[model samples]
Each structure stands twice: as C-alpha cells, then as structure tokens.
Target: MRQKARDLFEKLGYRKIMMAGMLLTGIILYGFLLDSVQSDTYDIQLFQLSQETIRSEKTVEDPVKTELERQRLTEEVAPSYQFMSEIVDNQTALVASIFGYILEVKAPPEQEEDRLTKEEMIEKLREDLRLLETSDNGLRLTDDMLSSLLSLSEARLLNVQKELNNLLESSLNESIRVEEVARYRTEIEQEIRRNETIPNDIIQAAVTIGRFGIIANEVVNEELTAKQVEQIRNSVEPTRILQGQVLVQEGQVIDREVYRQLELAGMTEERLNYKPLLGLFIFVIIAVGLLFIVISRSKKDDEHKITEMLVVMVATSISLILMKLLSAISNNFDLVISFFFPTALAGMLVCLLVNERAAVYVTIFVSAAAGLMLPSGYSATLQVDVAFYILFGGLTAIYLIDRVGGRGRLLHISLAVAFANALFVAFYLLLGQTQYSWSEIAFYFSAAVVSGLLSGALAIGFLPFFESAFGMLSTMRLIELSNPNHPLLKKILMETPGTYHHSLMVANLADASCEAIGANGLLARVGCYYHDIGKTKYPQFFIENQVNIENPHDRLPPEKSRDIILAHGIQGAQMLKKHKMPKEIIDVAAQHHGTSLLKFFYYKAKETNPDVDENTYRYEGPKPQTKEIAIISIADSLEAAVRSMKEPTSEKIKKLVDSIVEDKLKDGQFEECDISLKELKKVKEVMCDTLNGIFHSRIEYPKETN
Candidate 1:
C-alpha cells in the first residue's frame, strides 16, 4: 500500500508536489504568526477612572516609573566646581602696583624739576588705572581715591598702601565664586578697620579699593557636573514589574499609575493590529522565494528537487509549530519556555536529507520565524535575542551533524549541540545582565540542554519517515540498502550466484568511477547491486547465470532471445518498485541499457532473414537522466565486456572498456544526461585503472612445489 502511494506521488511530477509543499508551509507558518501578531490590548480610555481595575496580563518593566526615578536621582546630584587661582593672582598684583605708584608719586625726587604736581600725578595714575576698570578683574578705584592716597604724608601713605595690599592678598587667597565676592569684601573691610595705624578715612578708602580688586576665582565645571549627574542616574536601578505581577485589584478604580502599567504590559486595547501579520507574510514570501530560486538554479533532478522542497517546507513548519506550541504553554504558566524550543531539529533534518547549503538557508528562515512566533516580553515585533538563540543552536547542530558518518554519531552530535546551547544561553544571560539565582540559572541551563538533546532525538525519529515518504536516497538509507542481508540481495546470491558476482563487480566499478567524477558513489554502488535482479527470475536465460549450460539463445530464435534480454530492464524496475526502493535506484534498473540496440542479436536475425527490423532488438528506455545513472550504464557494460575477455591483459581490458564507452557515446546513450565530456573522460580513466588492478599479471608458481 505504501509502495503504491509512493508511485502515485512520483507520477504527480515535481511542479505539483512543490506547489503542495509551498502551500502547506505557508499555511502552517501563517497560522502560527497570526496567533503571535494578535496583540492582547484592553479597551480603556486614557486618564479616565475605570469602573473595573485592569491588572497586568504579563510581567513587564514599568518604563514610566523607571524613567521618573532616574530623573529624580539625576536632579539631586550637586553641580561640580573648579578653582581658578590665576584670577586671584592677577587681581592682587594690580592692587599692589596701584599702591606702589601712589607712594612713588608722593616721594621727593633728586631731579625736583622733573617731578609732577600732586594733581598731575593723580591724572597720570587715573589713566593707568582706567584700563583696570575695563578688565575682567572688575577693579574701578575712583580718581578721588587716588588723590586721597597721594595727599597723605609719604610714610602714612606707604603704611596705608601696605595695609590695603595685605587685606586684598589675604582675601583673594581662598576660593571665591562670583556670588560670594560680597562676603569676602565685608571680611576684608573689618580687617582694614582693625588696622588703626592709618586714619579711619584711609581705612575706609583702602577697604573700598581692595573690594574692587576682588573677583570670583572659582567657576562651575559644566562638563564634570554633567558626568556626575549621568553616573548618579545610571546607578539607580530600573524599577521593573515582575512577570505576572498584579498592578490593580479587580474592583479597584484605575488610577494614572495603573493605567500606565496596563499600557506597558500591552493590556490596553487599541484594536487588533494586523501589521505584524502582513510583515510575516512578506517575510514568508521572501524566504520561500529564495528557496525556490536556489532549487531552480541547482543541478538536481526533478525527484530530488521535489524531495528537497518537501523537506525544507516540512522541516521549517515543524520547527515553528513546535515553537508556537511551547510558547502557548509557557504563556499559560508564565515560564520562559522559548529557550527550550528545539529550533535546531529542522536544521539537523535538512542537513541529513538535503545539502548543507540548503540546511543553512532553512536555518536562517526558521530562526527568523521563531523570533516572531516566540513570546517576547511585551513587544509584538520579532525578538532579536530569540533570533540569535535559534540561529546559534541551529547552526551548531548543522556543523556537528555535517561531519557525522551515520545515525550512530547522532548521540555525539546531540552532546555537541547541548554544549553549544548552554554556551549561547550563558552568553545571552550575561549580555542582558539578567540576575538569575542559582536555581533559576540551573533551570534555564537545563532547559537549553534538553532543547539540544530533543532536537537530535526528534531529527533521528523523523529521518526515516522523511526518507521513506519522499523517497530520499539519504546516506543512511543507502548504507542500509547496501547490506548483504537485504532480502533481494540474499535471493540474488542464492539463486543466481554468477549474476550476483557480476553485480558486485559492476558495483565496485561504478562506485570508484562515480566517486572519481564527483557523483554519488554510494547511490551508484547500491543501484548497481539491484540493477540486474530481474535475471534471478530466469537464471539460465542470461549468460552470467548459465554457468555449465549451453547458450539459451542458441535454442531460440534471435528475435525471441532479444525479447528475453530486453525484458530484464523493465522487470527489474517492477521488482524494485514492489520492494519500495528509492526512485533513483529504480531509475538505474529501468534505464541502464537505454535504447541502444543489441547488435549481435540484431545481426543474427538479419542474417537469417534479409529484412529483420532493427528496432525489435533495441531495449525500451527513457534513457539515463542523471549523472549517477549514466555512469552506472557505462560501468555495467564495461564490467561484462572486460569479464568476457579471453586474454584479460591490462592493455586488452583498457581497450575493451574504451571501445564500449565510445560505442555508447556514438549511440547517443549519454545525450539526455548531464554528464560532461571531461567527467566522462575521468570516469573512463578510473574504470581502466580499476580494471587493470583486477586483471594485473601475476607471478607463476614453481612447478616443483606440486
């Protein structure tokens, strides 16, 4: 029944199968993405007191509260200050110079005629002091003040100038800002009054002049102050509402804070948003389109192309559906179960059933789909971390399984996958700075490990089904079929020993030749094993099976003999189909001889009857349509031809193999297949090498030994 169904699928052809796979993939993906896209929003007016209080549906960070707390902390930090000692030094020097000038003018000079009058000296001093008033120092001593200092006797003037300079220097020594200059001036005034050596009027005038010299030396450091505020803001921990935390009771009225929390938790209804669904549709289209383009451009046969499309679609769909199911369960229990989704299962299956490149492409598409389907904290869009997690896990599985030899290596691959999952989970937790307790960390780590092991286990479980359903000639299946214990192989060995030996020789030649030309050597060898199974039904009719008997064809007419010989191809294909073998191997049995004429039988008929039809001796064939089948055809013929050589020297064997391949080429047997001339030449050379090794000269043993 299964064989009949497989045959029916083969008859449906590639285009229909590919379309069905595409439609099924789109449906599965769209259903999951639609569920994710529907945001759960509450229908409540902004700022309006609610009749019924709304609690958070899921745990989320209160962005509004977190921001407010950070802002308040930042405002509480004090502005930083920097001291500028240079301003104090410049102002004090100006005061000392003004006082010294006054004393110098009051003193008697050796050249009395050159000395200026008091008023003239005062005018000159006013000019020098004019520039000081306009300076940043803010020093503006009046002309009257200068005249008052000059009017005093020279000794009293020096004493008053010394007193004023001492007061200004002491006041300017401390760090004073622009706002505190008045207080420093007041302190200096009291100090000057304490000095009774000069008159009270001199002390008052001196105090006023010293006050003008004082300026703010300390300034606000804007850059440093901003940095300090930023640090304070960052130090304040973010206030998060834990998952499943209730914001308000059912009967409690909705306040401003409760309303904001509902919005943050995505409980505020604003109608169902379909934008995510639309985006997901576009995403699916692009992913499917890319796969289509790659498959169309590749050199695979129609069956293989169909198989590839089916595997890709089915694997991606299964992975995403699993993610969605896990997400739904996690949402119910408030668990972060997205990490435990076996995202790498699809990638491992793809790598096993298809090529590595296709597996990589499938991994990327599956990761992106997972990001959308998985529950991200409060956002409806794709989660970047989930995407990274899936990508890391999937690629790791691909890399590990790519080097695997068979199903036996899957356990090791699973272990490697677990390590990769754990590493990525640790990295993600560390990057997000998530504070998980030892128990929580262990739970997450264990989940990740389970995800990896489950991915491998699921892949192993599904592999055989896919290989059987899609008729995929996977390496594992090929290896299984190549075993001698297979029923058909056992039958061939028991019933037709000569044909069995011939099939083995053909398998060896085909395997070596296919490998040399970069074809599927295993498929070729396995196909060759069952290529002549039809001979077992009529053991004595074929030459290989007629070991001690006369030629069966000599007793029958040439036309009847040709019919018996040509029936093997079709009969062998039917027998394989009965056993439900892969389509590729069955194709080898059906199309190995192609439509090439049986020249010996045709010539024998022509000699007996002058007008024998040539088509009667030709085998019915669709021709070899793949490189593997084409190489098998050539290898099968060459093996039989080389075995029949009476004098099987290296030179004779080489010549026979070359002649057979050339004759098949002339008959256009390889025209329909994709075997290039260069590959064919390599195949010929490999065959000659293998044949030479088998038929190489051996040393003669000494007669005396008998």
Candidate 2:
C-alpha cells in the first residue's frame, strides 16, 4: 500500500501540490483570521452597544442629543462610510499598477535619415583617404628616411631641403644640379602635404543627429490630466522625429500611470464589493478543480488515480498548514509584516520540490486564499484587495526568482522578499495617497524576513509529514542522509572504510551521469552513497569494499557465495527501514542489484556441481524504477568493474562503461521504469569521464621521503 502511494506521488503534478497547499492554507488562515476579525468586531460592537446602553439610561432620566449620537454610530458602520474599504481598494489599485501593456517603439524618421547620411559620409571619406594613402605609399615612401621627410609641415619641409643642400655641398667636390629629379621630388612633397579644404560637416552632422522620437498617447484611462499625459508622451519620445510623424498610436498610455490604470482596471472600492463567502467558495472550487486537471489529466492509468490524488492532496495540505502557521504567527506580532506572505513562501517551495511552471499556478492559489483570509473593512471589499496583494506578491516572487539552489542562503532570500514587498506596498501607497510612517517600512522589512523564513520553515517541518502521509520521499531528505557525518554514513566510514570510499566515488560518477541525462543528480549521488549500505552487515564479503579481506566469499561454496551476495540487497533494505529512511532510498538500495546473474559465483557453482541451478545464484528481483536509481545502479557496477583494468585507457573505459550499460539493457534491467535510452547513453559517457578522473596519474611516493 505504501509503495503504491509513493508511485502515485512520484507522478503527481505541481497543480495538485499547490491546490492542497492552498486549501490547507486557506482553511487554517481563514479559521484564524475569521476568529481574529470576529473577535475584534465583537469588541467594537460590544463597545458601541455599551455606549448606546449608557445613552439610553441617560435618556430615560432626561432627553439630550442621544438619538443623534446613535445615528452617528450607525453612520460609522455604513458600507460607503467605512474608511478601511477605501484603503484596501486603493492598495489593490496600487498593486494593479505593476502590470501594464508595453508598446515597443519603432524607428523614428529623422534618426533613420541622419544615421544613413552619416554612414554615407564616413564611407566617402574612407574611400578618399584610402586612395591618397595608397598612392603615397606606392611612391617608395615605405622607407623610413623618405617617410620621415614627407611627414614634416611645409615650412619644416623647406628646412629639411636646406639641410639636404648643405649635406650635398659638404660631401661633393663640385656643384651638382639635378633639376628634373628635384622638380619631381618637389611635386611629390606637395602631393603628400595636408589638404585643409574639406569642411567639418561630418562632425557637425554627427553632433546634430537625433536617434529617435515618440509621442505617447494615454488611451485607456482619463483620470490623468492632459499635462500628465503629455509628460508621459514626452518621456517616451525618441530624441528626433520626422515632421508630421505620429510617434504614439491612438488609445495608448504614452507615459504609463500604473496605479491609476490599475484603479481603472476595477481595483476600486465599488468594484471589489461582493458576497464574500460565495466568492471565496467559488474561487476555491475553480482553482482546485483546475489544479486537479493540470496534474491528473495527463495520466490515463485508472489504477493509479485514487492513490495519486490522495498523496498529492495530503502533501499539499501539510504545506498549506505550515504556510498558515507562519502567516498567523507573523501577523500576530508587530515585528512581522509582508504584503505577500504565503505567496512568496509557496513560490520558493514550488521551485524546490516541483518545477517553475507549477510554482506559478500554486502562487495564484495561495494569493486567492490570502485574500479570503486577511482583515477588511467590508468583508466583501477586503477580500478583493487581499486577492490583489496575494496574486501580485506570488507572481512577482516567482517571476523575480528564476532558479532554485539558494535554499540555505537565508539572508539573500529575505532581502529579495523585502525588496519585492516594499516595492509592492510603496507603489500602492504613493499612487493611492495612502498614509504611512517609518514604522510601516519597518513592518515591510519584517514581512520579507517572515516570508523567506516561512518557506524554509515549512519545508523543514512538513517534509517528514508528507514523506509519511503521501509516501513521497523528496530529494532534500536524501541529501541530508548522504552527508558523511550522518550516523549511518559515519559508521560505514569507520567500520567499512573501503566500502565508504567506494560509495563516495560511485556517488560522484552517478551524480555526473544523472545530470548529463537530465535526471535528479543529487538524488542519484545520495542514492549511490547508500546503495551498497547492506554490505556493512558483513564487510569482508565484497572485495573492493572490504578491508583486510581473507577471501570470505572465496572460502564459501559457490552457492553460498551467491546467496551472500544476493542477500545484501534485502539486508540493506531492512537496515534502511529500521533506520526509518525514506522508501525511495530503500528502493534504490534493494533494487539496484536487480535479479542479474552473479556470473562468478554461478560459474564456480556449475564447475563444482554440474547439477547446480543457476536460478539459485540470482539476486532477489526489483529493477530500477526511476532515472536516479537506474543511474546509481549502473554507476555502482561500473565503478567496481573499472578498477579491474590494469592499464585503463580512455578508450578502454568508454568500452567498459558501454559494455556494462549494454549488458544491463539487454537483460531488460530498465524495462519497468521510465529510464530512456538517450539518458542511458549519457550515463555511459559520464561514467567514462569519472573513471578517467579517478585514475589520473599523480607523483608516486618516494622511498627517500618515507
């Protein structure tokens, strides 16, 4: 029954987990908030009633403005007169501002013309310079003497000529006049002289050129003034625009006022009011049913549906309860605050335990639940405002956080949550003209901490419950157990050092293999670490993992040797169960060896006793059921088998890993599971790489040093 439940959970989707969390969170948060709200309401109501009673006693003795005071009290409770409703609505409006339709800017006409003309001028100058430089170089100006002489200014050139004349007079016995050669040299010098004729048009044009232009048009909302709209338009405009060009399209918010637009999008007090209980119930049903569909619809197997639903629902419920406890505690304290509490908490979890896409939907569910569970002026109006905060907070958290592995980085995660919530609340307050103080900022910072801590706390507290209730073991718990400091792991290291070292090597190989195949690398690595833990019972039975071995297995009969080898899987599974390890780990340890033949033991038995049955030498059966387990099983064998090679080369390691994988495949070891052939090939490649690393050459110990 437990195995069945686990299998179902393994197949459950993000939606189911989220729905369960939402429902649980809603129930707890709602129960608590409703109680708190009711308690406060009762106090306020009792106070008002007491005042009325006092006035009645006064009126019975003598008449005054007692009736007027009663009327005033009634007015205070009126729906339109309630101040909190407006605050919540305004908050919603501010949150709505975070979303706006983006208009991509097109190229402006003036910028385009300017850019083209500049390019044309640069091209022309480049061509002209190339021709003059090329001609000057071809006239033997490559020589340093001639090149240096040509580089001088016109006056400097004449000084050089005078110097050359003096040199010729000093060196010669008689006067020499080569007029043609001198004339040619003079003409060449004039050609090489700088031309100052070109205008500074290029620099002028480059400086004057404008890149683009835009005309923003506020189309959807009219609450903003024409001047405000013009400001938005001007802000969006590209620096240069062609004459009569419409830079902005009609009915567009040229400069976006997100808060006002969000208000216009029905986040106002009038639009928020609804039958609170009915709205909450209906929304929950739609959300739950939709979530169920996303998670369960993809599967066609009838045998698994009931079990899957139960596990998913149970896992989700535990998560939700944790979220509620954290939220309730945070809300109760003046030190705790966040605009979107449960939503952010759920976002990080969805990323850790599930995929990002699932986290998104889960966040939505939590947001809606939060709306139903927060305090409001009019119960109906309050729900809507709360929903906005919840949705925006959840979506924003997930959107901002894209990757998952920063789980232990609490401070960093808290800062992220704080900034998000601050922006959310600040935007609302500023746009809605909501009042705030330094205390509010402090509250927001506290809320961010609460949000991040809640996520971590929930994962830690609920992990065990979910593992038990749903039989769904997670990667997190596996990693915790794989640590060398763990009691079981430490025992293995101290008592069975060879096995422990072997396990670590196998873990590295399996981890890399699983990642290459797009499987859970951590799960693979951790599973590998514990896959042979059964050998700890009789440490000297296995060769590589044995220390001071006197060939215990060799001394035993072939049949006995096979039995001992096969018994390790069962032994490992029993040990894990006794230690209360998660079922996933137990499966990895028990099933990793599968029912493959113990070739050495079987052949030895056959040689000694011709009538011996090969079946008696086989392992108890249950093949790899997932990619992580499958990769670990292969890694365990490959790591052991690779060490047998005397001079292991890259090519030999590749063949060895491939042969092991092919043998496993041919024997149908992966038939019952979802391990794909492509993944298997990747695993083979990783094993080869790891083997090379392990066997890489290092300096041998020197006898002199010893």
Best-fitting candidate, measured by lDDT? Answer: 1
Candidate 1 minimal-lDDT segment of 10 residues? 51-60
- Per-candidate local distance difference test: 0.80, 0.54
**lDDT for predicted candidate 2 compared with the true structure:** 0.54
- Model 2 TM-score, 2 decimals: 0.55
RMSD of each: 7.6, 32.5
In TM-score terms, candidate 1 sits at: 0.70
What lDDT tens digits, residue by residue, belong to model 1 across residues 57-109?
Answer: 44567777888998888878877889987876677677777777777766677
**Candidate 2 lDDT tens digits, 379-467:** 32235554565566556656655333333443355456656655665665576554667887666656545655555555556556656
Q: Specify the highest-TM-score model's number.
A: 1
Q: Which ranges in model 2 have alpha carbons more than 4 Å from their true place? A: 1-286, 293-343, 348-356, 376-432, 440-444, 546-550, 692-706
TM-scores, all candidates, are: 0.70, 0.55
Residue 634 miss distance in model 1 (angstroms):
0.9
